[model samples]
Every structure is written in structure tokens, then in C-alpha cells.
Target: MNKISYIRWFNEIGIDDVPLVGGKNASLGEMYQNLTAEGVRVPNGFAVTAEAYCSVLEYNNAWQSLHAALDGLDPDNIRDLQARGEKARAIVYGCQLPDDLQVEILQGYAQLKREYGETISLAVRSSATAEDSPEASFAGQNDTYLNIASDDALLDGYKRCLASNFTDRSIHYKYDNHFDYYKVYISVVVMKMVRSDIGASGVMFSLDTETGFKDVVFINAAHGLGENVVQGTIDPDSFYAHKPSFVMGYRAVLKRRLGSKEKKMIFTNTLNTGNIAVEYTKNIDTSSEERSHYCITDSDVMVLTDYAIKVENHYSNKAGSYKPMDMEWAKDGLDGQLYMVQARPETVSSQKKGNILEIYHLKERSVVLLRGRAVGTKIGAGKARIINDVKHLKDFQPGEVLVADTTTPDWEPVMKIAAAIVTSRGGRTCHAAIVSRELGIPAIVGTENTNEVIKNGQAITISCAEGETGTVYDGLLGFEIQQTDLSQLGHPKTKIMMNLGNPDQAFSFASLPLDGIGLARMEFIINPTPRESPRFSHGEESGKLVLT
Candidate 1:
């Protein structure tokens, strides 16, 4: 058989091919290769390689033009940067796909049709080289076309994905991350669409996103397309499953939150102004009946939680270490089957030092100004800065609490500088909550009227240390931070094991007078350190020293 250049099937690739297929495709291929036989459902797909993307630009004579447009451009000058980015994208859009690449894509699609059927609708998604990495997640920074049914539309989607590499946000992200524009390349992932329009779709994390708690699987689900949940356009239903207890056949669903999912994105067939047939997503108002019901059932929740645990365990065993994953899942209402669309390494708390638990307590009683789902186990107090738009993000001073109606990826620049975040709309998996947790800042989301109730420049206390309900208090209420030493603690008859996840805290934890560490999350200690390697078999006793 001759070597194929343009496309690589999901079964033919793995995580090692990230340079060729990009992170998203690489992860999909990884799951398909390693977990499909284990009963995990991943939609069949093929990736247009980075080499194909480069060839397309070279064939269209746009490579030189794009580089020249980017030459000496000041990324800090927003207008100039946007203008250059637009010019580059225009060049990509103006060009046509090389005949060979087009033939390859069509051939790949035909193979899928042979397997799935002739009327199989596809999703074309952009997968940049640096996206979905453990260091930085460029989520929702590119384009994705769903329900593409024709050859022309598929080709067009490919071009759009290529052009999306020059989106203003993409350009700014590259500049902000110090990634060389020339080195970053784009790959297109063409996969069988999971018919999420007919059912439900959302995101799931193997570990608790809020507090870096390793014993739970956090899932967020909403009707129709999963983008709404990821983009923070709608609040979704939240589910938390206790992982430790789950293994013992206990359905430990710790909590469930029903969101006001007022809108849904459904795929529809329509004709363009030019009379061309196209498949697009239409935003329809969700009925009161739909809003009041859960998108998924209790059975589905258990299945999803089980899959999360299985995926984590599979990857952990493969890498000879623990691996917490961020995954996207969808249900096919037509067939009542669920599918895993994408999975990647969890970037946030997994990378942080988790030795110390900073417990916060309010020193004085105060009136609660607002309440919502808490995203951390700490307290923050600062002047509240109510920001309604991204244009005035710079006006927000550092150490001020960021109060917003909602937040998108654009608000990240100012969100990092905030001492805390309070949002009027969003769930635990929304952008505001996710970023706040990653930044180690306290956040209270889904307050519904936080922006209206909270005034600008008012001193307020944001407390997420109190269970699931986060509260915003009026004035600068006094608080105390108590750092408990892991080494020195009172002993009891029963074993008191420490939850030592970060390797940096291993030595300190080892000095503790407890029986032993209960869950030393392997991903945290995977990186090489000066000390000996830590190794433990499954189901080990508490007193046994696991660290080598």
C-alpha cells in the first residue's frame, strides 16, 4: 500500500502524532485506538494533516502573503493586529483547495459513507497545533461547521477552518502566549456528527474542577449543541459523582443543579441566498417544558460517570501514572447511545501544588448580599468592579472583585487580575468558573442578579469556602485564613491519610504522623524530581509506604 499524505484515520494515529494531527485530533485518535475495544464509543473520523494545511496555503500562493502581512506587525496594537489577521484570512478564503487534497478529503468521506451510510452528516472542526495542551487550552478559539452533507460544503468547511487560524482571538492568543505565528499550523478534523441536535451534549471532567478534589467526576449537560455550555451562553444542568464510592457500586451523586436552559442550537437544512444547499445551526427558544426537565436521566448520569472513571483509569494505566481528563460527550436521541467526541489532559488544578488546604472563616457576621454556586474553597474580599462589556475591561483595577453579567474567552485578560469573580449567569463548567478555578481565585456563579444587586466600587467579601453555596457579603467583612500543617496532626484509632496530589508536597507529607497518604494522584508526581519515584499497587493498605 502507498503512503497517504493528506488524511490519517482515527485508528491510525495516537497522542504522539499531535505535531501532525494537532491536539484535538491526536486525542480523538488516542481514545479511538486505546479505548474503543474497552467499550468506549468514539465517532469514526479522519484528520487533514498539518502538512495538508501547509500544502493548501502553498498551492494557493497565500503562504508568502500571510507571512509578509504578519511581518513587523505590532500584536499590542489591536486594530493593526486585527487588520493583518483579516488580510491573512481573506487570502485563505480567496484560494481554492488543491485538486489532490480535495480528492483525498472526498475519498476519506466516501470511506465514512461506506461504513456509516450514504447520508451521514459530518462535522468539520479546526484543530490548531497548540490547542488543548496541558499548558494552555485554546478552547472555542476556532471554527466548527456541523451537519455538512455535501462535498462542496466539506471543502468549504476545510477552507473556513484554515482561515479561522487568523481569527482575532487566535492571533491575540498566539501573541499573548509568545507562540511564533509561523510555527503554529492548523489541521482540520472531519468526523461523523453525533446528532447532538436530537439529544443532549456537554462537558465532563474526571476530577472536580472547582477545588481540585480528585474523588469526583463533574459533568455539565444541556440540550442541543455542546457549544452553548462551553461558550457560557446558557447555564446547564450540573452533576457530581463521587468516584471513590462509585467503584463499590454506590451511586453517590453528591449534587445536581438544574439550570435555566432557555435556548438550544439545532441543526437544520436550509438554502442560502445564492440557492446553495447548506446545513446550519438555528437557535430556537426552549419551551418551558424543556427548561423544567433534565436533559439526561439518572441512568445516563451513572453511565457517564462510569465512563469518566474508565477513561481516567485507561489513560493512567497506559502512561503508568494517574491521568485526569477533560472530556466532551453527546447522546444520540435517535438511537439512545452516548459518544465521546473529544478528550484531553486536564490543565488547571492538576498542574498546581495541592499540599496545603487554606481554610477561610468569616470573623464577623454580615448580611449576605448574593448567593450562588461556589467554585473554590477560599475567601476573597475586594472592591467590586461591575463590568458589562469587554471594552472597559482595562478600567478594572487589580485585586478588585470582577462582577459581570457573564463572561466569555475575551474577558480572560482582566479575569486573571481579579481577586474574585461573580457572574449573573454560568455553571461550574462555564468560562468564568473554569478560569477562576484555574487562576486559584474564588468565584460565585449563577447568581441570576449579581450584576443588578452588586454596586460598582463597593467593598464586598466573596466566600466560596462554605460548602456548595458561595456568598457575597456587604462591606469588608473580616476573615481568617488558617493553614493547617500536614506534618503535625492529632491521631485517632482510625487511619488519617493525607490527600497528597502534588509531588512538591510529597516530602512534607511524608513527614506527617498519619498512617499514610490515601490518594497520591500520580499525574501530579509524574514529572521527575530529586527524590525517588513513588509507586503503589491498587488497593494498598494505609500504613504501607508507597513512595519509593
Candidate 2:
């Protein structure tokens, strides 16, 4: 594959191949090819091609230079690590652009111009081989230079991108992923950009974060480029859209502010709508307000929705082909276009019948507590010990009981290696319970104070199959699968689920035929650190209080 020509790489792999395609190219291919097939209007753009990147790195013998700079620095020493990363980047930027790769890039840009129009402003971005992952979003890890003014800027932007591999965040991620210094590669894509008078954009997910319900489409739309939404920097307009109904069930925000064309950066005279002509602005940092505008109209929204569904379906189909996917997507509001940004293996277990065999009788409602949530069901038995970070998670030896405030996505890897799972926040619909049940392990959620009551590495027993009343034995008491039909659980129509913090939770719930989730909290979705909630937030915040 390394020896293959750049053009061939673009032809065969395309954007669908996330691992090898590189993120920017994959998104372009997804939007321009697949999503367009379903009739969505994506902003026009062309990928500079990953092969071009490889050719540049290989031809320049740049790997050795970069390697020499970052060769033996301790990955954990963030300060020294950053300084070395900067040094490597300086070397990459200092090198001259190769003639042939430059020519190819220019040709792609020229082709885009012929198609989208010569004056089209473009968004030049870095799509490295190692970025945009299930475990890592690669948020701002690479450079995405928006609103390029001329051809010269585009070329420079590409160089800037190559240099960005050395950015602090990118360096840290590479270290965390254990990517080899010499092996890490990057791709550049110079896309025909969307120029909007009113900039509005944001991210949307197929599942609800507050609840694990798979039926709802959770959206966070803001006035600007959607950066605020991804970074959790702004209180964007939040909505819950029901999938089956395709209707907005709920929407909330403190305020709504759109971007304006009056700013000096206005590059286009086109107006998307009379009412939405202004771009939205939100206070991102203390300095000047961050601005964004939405160009997708109501009709465009419908078109984008259809496109989003197709992109999602494509991902689902791929995952189904191998094993179905749990996915994420974002849209370019400027063009009423949707982009398939991420996809991952679905791990939540199938739900089981509320059979007698699935049920376990509990000794009493003697449970530990942790961080709390608004709602959820309880399972398991023990004095819950709240774990905070990867260090704390690693501290657990085999057979030592574990508990948390709430689970998050990052916690997935560690959960696979834990003795037991307990939380104070999630309900039957939560990620923790779902994954636990799938793993066929004991998990108790909504067990408030599991953190306060249990000490680190304390011995305990747990049972999710246990009835509403369960006993907490200081020693290992039992392991059981308490099951119940959703119909009998009060909401016969809705799927009952527990919230989860990590990917392992999903796998743990793999055996049950759960109608999917009613909620999957993205927060508490990762492994907890020592400082946060003591890993018992669910217990203290949402679980029942038991006085022995």
C-alpha cells in the first residue's frame, strides 16, 4: 500500500475506508459520493489526497528528521514532549514543497474550481492517518484552515497542516495511541468551501446522551461553525428528535444568536434567507465573541436530514455487514449538507425476556452510593468505591470490587478489566447497566452513595438480576442475572436502558435483546479520574438512599 501511487490510493480506498482513507478524504468521499447518492447538498470540495501526503513525507526523507527530534522524549513529560513536538514541526515547515505533489494538488484544486466555479473559497484541512477515531475525536488535533482567499494560501495551508502534526494536542494523542514517530502519516484535502452570510452549524447524534434511547436524534445546533458545540464551549440550541416520528420532541437554549455578514471576513454576497441573514455569535472565550452563521434553510434542513439519515444508514449498513455500528455525524449548515464523521462497533447486548430465570432475589436494599442523576434503575450489591482516573482504574487488582460515579466512553477499555460495575446515575437504559448485563456481570446503577460508602479496593458482591430489594454482603455473596420484560416494567411501549460511560459497558450488555437504549450519557462516559466524583456520582446523585 505504501508503494502504491497517490491516484490509485484515492481511487480504491475512497473515503469509506476510515482507517486507511484518512479523515478528511473519508468525509469528502462520504459527503460527495455516498450522501449525494441519497440526494443531500454537501458543500463542494476536493481532497488533496492522502497519497500526496505520503509522497511528500517519503520524498523529503522528512520522517528521519521528525524522528530525530521526537526520538526518545518521555511521552508522559508533557512540557518536554510539547517542546520537542514544536521542534519537529519547525523542521517540516522549513522544508520545501516537492514539485510533483504540488502540481497534483494544484490540478485537484483547478478541477474543483472548474466544477464549483473559479472564485470558490475553499476549506483546506489535514486528514492524518491516525486522527478522528472512536476512542479519540481528534478534536482540533490537526489544522483545518477555513476560508482560503487564494491559490497561494491553499498551498501554504497544506504546509501549515503538515506542520500541525507537531501541535501539542496532536503530539499528545500520538503518544497516547502509541503511534510510531516514523510511521505516522498525514493527508491534505483542499475542499471547495461553503461561504455563508449567516453561519449556523452544529453536531447531531442518533442517540440521546441524557438517556440511552436509540430512537431519539440528539442535536446541538449553534449559530457559528459548530466548533462551539463540539468543544462544549457554547450553550447551543439543544433538541431531541424522535427517529420513528421524525419530529422535534424537545428544544432548549438560553439564547439564540446567529452570525452576521457585517463582519470584515464576509467573503460572499449571497444571502441564504432574510431572517437568518445574520451569523450567530456566542462567547467562546474571554476575548472577542466567536461567530458562526447558518445557511441551510427549512427546505435545506429537510434535505440535510435526508442526507444525514442516508449517511447514518450507510454506516449502519457497513457495521451490519461486519456487525452494525453505533455512529456520529455533523452537518455543514452553510450548504444544508451532512457529513459522516465517525462510526464504531455497536456493543449493547440484545434484550432478554423478563423470565423467572433472569430474576435474582436480593437480601435487602443495602447498596453503596456514588454520583447521582435525574433517573434510573438499580442493580448489584456492595459498598461502592468511586474510581476517578485511569490511574485509579489501574489500581484495582483482580477480584477487587469497583464502582463509579457514572461511566463515560473512555472508560470502555478499563471496564473490560474490572471486577464489577456500579453507578449512581444510569437507569435500565444507561450505558453502564446495558454493557454490564451484556458482559453477564453484576452491575448496579442508580445506587447513590456507592462512592461514599465503599472504600478503594473493598470486597463486595453484586447482582443486577436481583429484585428491587437486594442485600450487600461485605464478602462475595453471589452473581446472578436479574431479568424482567420491559412490558412488565411499566413502560411496555418504551425500551428501558441504563446509562453507560464506556464501550465495555455496551459489550457487557451484549446478551440481552434490549430494544436498544433510552439514554446513553456521553459525560461519565469515560473512565473516571481520582479527582472526579470518586467514581460514585451515580450513587450519590441518582440512586436510592439506604439506611442500615
Candidate 3:
């Protein structure tokens, strides 16, 4: 107990502790230790190390059996994968923590209780040691227990988080990333839960997620807990702020799009989840007035922009490179203050190769079936397969496009094979978008009504290359791929600075041999005053984008 190896306080750990505390906790520690004085409001917390999880399972003699259950897991074999994953999880969950670790865990919880009082509801989140990397972002591959109000619930939540390491998505992700299943570990982050259930919660990216444009901050916010937004269960209000112009004290607000926000996830006292009673969160329909208004104010957007840029700059400097960040934030209704909960590297756009340009031009334009937030620049044509329920996805073919309201980690198997993906809800950072980017496939999300309009087995062409507004053509439309290797092309004699507005074209513009960006317009000059979507046509002289 005196050695103190099982737990790490947020201030006591740094990014180097990822092996022990996992990426999420490590990043939280990094921000906590480094950025609080800078006004980045990160809630205080502690993390139960992976070593603790390993020791508990080993001490209980369940380690080998758990490994045995998942050994040789064939990710492609869905049924087998499920059976083995369940077995492995049960094995881990059944294991009891050793006396020493249990005492330490209680002591850790006591410290929080002393600070926040006895009934301090906590947020228990899982952080895999290998997650949040540019090559492999394990998006929602595990469980998150919110509003856990007691030590017993905390212990159970801890075990549940560890067990989630063997979830279907986690297993497939490990296999796909060529990770050693045995070596990968899960750390449990128990943080002071924000009362966003009374305020707002959401996720934000330091860069334009759709275009990999690093000069803008893209945010998706909802009325309650962040799970709804992160889970793609709700199409949250979207906001954009130009970082450079914002920093220069110019009118930084770029665009704001209102979502239907028909539902909001709120905290509940307790619920029985598979016989275990735990503090749970529930989703309920939003009022017409709540649906009509924005979750956070415009002034709040600017404040978030400041915090996001600071965090991104800090992480980017730590890595000695530009590491755009993916962060989660919440507004404490009691205090009416915004607090940053978590931050990690913005994986997809940051990791993409900006040296080459690949444009998809539809040779034959057809009736535009629908439009949405585009993910990736690729184009895909396939039979539209309406997957209303995940159970019906068994008949989904490799070359077909998956059409759904939303996609979860459980949908990865079908997602890997699909030529393209179309979802009626979710934004660029949602599950569908994250997975599609990883699978190197195109996806159109937040379409509103694709499931109603697009028929099953109908041939459709999905294009994300023209701009941010991804268009789904009625039929299989022939397209031309214009590949431009900037490395192969020579620079022009005169410096060619470009005028930019549409966020979509920024990625493509970066591939061109340019002197610099002349301007990055902060107003709605290029795009029509957007009401619900960011993907709009470009307008005049408006220009100002500082990529360099």
C-alpha cells in the first residue's frame, strides 16, 4: 500500500504514463498538470492503472482463462467473435480485486469524497493503452459509466470498464490494427462528473474534421450528456470558428447549424443494467422550444475556441508537431462554466497525406438524392442497402452501401466491407464518420431522411470530393478521379496565393502548390447563410486561411 503503484492522480501522471493509465487519462493528466492556470477547466480526478486490472485478474486466477477465451478470435466470424468476447468479459468481470488494490481504490475514492463531499457522482471511462493514435483511434470501443454515485458503484464500474476491453469493436480494432491482444491493456478513469445533464455536453475537434483543415475548430453540442452526441444518437448543433482570425481578434464565428435535436440524454437516479443496479443516464424527447434553440451561446463558442486552440497548441508543441486535438467538453449548469473533460489527438485529418490530391468528378450528373456532412474525399458507388436494424445487416454485401440512422461500434463488421456508408444522423466525428475514415471509405452523415427516400438495393453514387456537401446521386453515376501529385508538379514562377471559404476545398487546396492563403473569411460570404448544414456553395473575395 505504501508503494502506491495501483493508482495515479491526474497531476501525478503525464502523457508518458499512457502505458499505465492509458491515453485518455494520460491526456487528462497532461492537461491538468499543464493547462488549468491557462483557463482550461479540467475537472480533477484519479485513474486506476492497468497494472491494477492485470493484478486483480491474475490474483483471482482468471487471467489465463480470459486469454484462452479470446485466443485466436476470428474478427470476421461475427457469431464466434460475440461468443468469445462475452466469455472473455465474463471471465474478467468475475475476478475480484486483491485486498491491497481494493484498499487503495477505496482510499482514492475517499480523497474525491473529501473534496467533493460523500455523494459526488463520478464519470467512469475506459482508456485503452493503445487508443487515440493517428493510425488507430478506438472510438467508443468500450463502456462509460456516468453518474456513478458511490464507492461500490465505482468498483463495479471499474471492473466493467476493464471487461469492455474485450468488446466486439475492441477485439476487431485490435485485430485490424495488428495489435497484440494480450499486451493491450485498459485503464479506468474516474473523474468528477460534470452536471451537463442540467447544462450541455459535446465533442469538438481542433481542426475541420471533414477537410483536415487545421485552421478551424469544429464542434457538435447537445442539451445533455456527451454520450448522445458521441454515440451519434442525436444530431447536435454544429459550430465553426476560424482559429487564425479568431486569435487575431476578428469576428471569428464562421457558421452555426441548428440540428433537430429531438432527444436529450439526462442522468437518472439508478437503473438495472442486466441485473446490476447502477446509476444510469437516459435519453428523452426534447421540447419544441429546446429543439429550436442552440445549446451554447455564440459567446460561449468563442470561449471554447480559445480553450481548444490553447489545448491543441500545447499538445502540438509537446509532440514537436501540429497535433490537432479531439476534445470533450461540458458546461456545469450549477456554475454556468464550461469545463474540458477529455482531449486526444485529432486522428483522421491530421494523419492524412496532404501531398496528393484525389478529386471525384461525376461525369454524368443525376438527380441529387440527398446531401450531408461528407466524410473523406473518396467516392463510392454501390447498391443502397437500408439497414434499419443491425440484425438485418447479415444480408449486407461487400460492395453495397450501408444506409442507417446511426452506426455503433457493433456495426464495424458490416462497415469494413461496405463500398460507402450513408447515415441519416451524426456528424463528421460520429461513429460512422470515424470508422469510415479508418476503413478508407466515403460516408455521408446527418442527411435527415436518407432511410425514407433511398430504396433498398437501389444503385447509388456517393461523392464527397466536390466539397463538404456530399451528394448521393440516384443511380450509379460515372466519375473521374483526378489524381494530382504535388510532389511531381513544379512550382509556378509567381507565388499563387489562393482565396478560400468553403471548408471542404481546404484539404484539396493544401495539395496544390500555393504561395499562401490570402484570406480565411470568418463570415457567411461564400456559403449561403447556413441554417442547418455547414456544407454550402462558395461566394466572392472572402478569403483568409492560415495553414502555414
Cα deviation of 532, candidate 2, in Å: 32
**TM-score for each model:** 0.84, 0.56, 0.91
- Ten-residue stretch with the least lDDT total in model 1: 502-511
Q: Each model's RMSD to truth, in Å?
A: 10.5, 12.9, 5.5
* lDDT (C-alpha) at residue 418 in model 2: 56
lDDT of 2 by residue, 1-548 (tens): 55443432222444456555576566556556655556655555555555666667777788788778987877555456657878988887777777866776677777777887776767776777765444444445677666665656667778888787777557755666677655656677666565432355555545543224455444445454544444332334434444555434222221122322112223332334642211222232211354243333344344334444455677657546422223334444355455544333334321222332233444444343333221112334444456765445544444445577666433444454455676644343345543454445555555555666767656676643322222245554544445655444343465656554443234234234555533254333332222343233354465642222
Consecutive 10-residue window with the lowest summed lDDT within model 2? 254-263
Ranking by TM-score: 3, 1, 2
Q: TM-score for candidate 2, please give it.
A: 0.56
TM-score leader: 3
Candidate 2 local distance difference test against the native: 0.51
Q: Residue 473 of model 2: what lDDT?
A: 50
Model 1, residue 410: distance off in Å is 2.8
Q: What lDDT score goes with residue 242 in model 1? A: 82
